[model samples]
Target: MRCAQFRTALSARLDGEPSGLPEVRLDKHVARCTGCRDWLARAQRLRAQVRTGTADGPSPEWSARLLVRLGEDRTGEQPPGPR
Candidate 1:
């Protein structure tokens, strides 16, 4: 498989999304292609960080403010923060 196709499938597999390639094909490509192997490693690391709650996200305060804004919109009330 081409590097681009392999990379795309690698990402999809990591994301638990549907992939067209067989599992054996994906594994074989990663084993033979150093570049694809590195890409898979990086993707796995990032996925691990996300699963461990270390991925970047809005601060608690920011998330609270966003929730308040969403609630206000739903209830047709003015939100507290500057728009």
Candidate 2:
């Protein structure tokens, strides 16, 4: 399978869904593909953080910034700050 298919399967597998690839093949792919290996490592770290309640949460400051940006998007009026 290509890298994109492998990534989609990896996500499903992580979520305990049925990934089409068997475990052995998945391991082989992960072992050989440096990009996939790095992606898997990051996904594992993010999963760990979420499981342990250590995942980064958006702070109030960021949330307000997002709201402002979204408002600009809806109204076609740019906020008086950096784009």
Candidate 3:
């Protein structure tokens, strides 16, 4: 299978979805393909970050701005400008 297919399967696997490809086949391709290996590593890290909500998780300031905007949407008022 091509690298793209492998990468797609890798993403599916990471997402706990069925890849439709055998795990052994995926492992063999990743073992021989440097790009796939790197991709798998990066995908794993990203999955970890997403699961923990800390992959460059939103800053407090950003969260505050979002909250303010949401409140404004409900209240029909403009959000305050940045300080």
Best by TM-score: 3
How many clashes show up per model? 0, 0, 0
Model 3 alpha-carbon miss at residue 66, Å: 7.3
Candidate 2 lDDT over residue span 1-83, tens digit each: 68988988899999999988888888899999999999999999999999998999998778777878676543567778764
Worst 10 residues of 1 by lDDT: 67-76
Cα RMSDs, all models: 4.4, 6.2, 4.1
Model 3, position 49, has a per-residue lDDT of 88
Please give the lDDT score at residue 66 for candidate 2. 84
- For candidate 1, the C-alpha RMSD (Å) to the true structure equals 4.4
Q: What is the lDDT of residue 31 in candidate 2?
A: 96
**lDDT for each candidate structure:** 0.86, 0.87, 0.86
lDDT of 1 by residue, 1-83 (tens): 57999899989998889767999999998999999999999899999999999988999878767878576544468777775
Each candidate's TM vs. the true structure?
Answer: 0.63, 0.67, 0.73
Which of the predicted structures, 1 or 2, would earn the higher lDDT when compared with the native?
2
Off by over 4 Å in 1: 56-83
In terms of TM-score, how similar is model 1 to the real structure?
0.63
The digit string of per-residue lDDT tens for model 3 on 1-83 reads 57999999989998899998999999899999999999999989988888898899778778767878666544467767765
Number of backbone clashes in candidate 3: 0
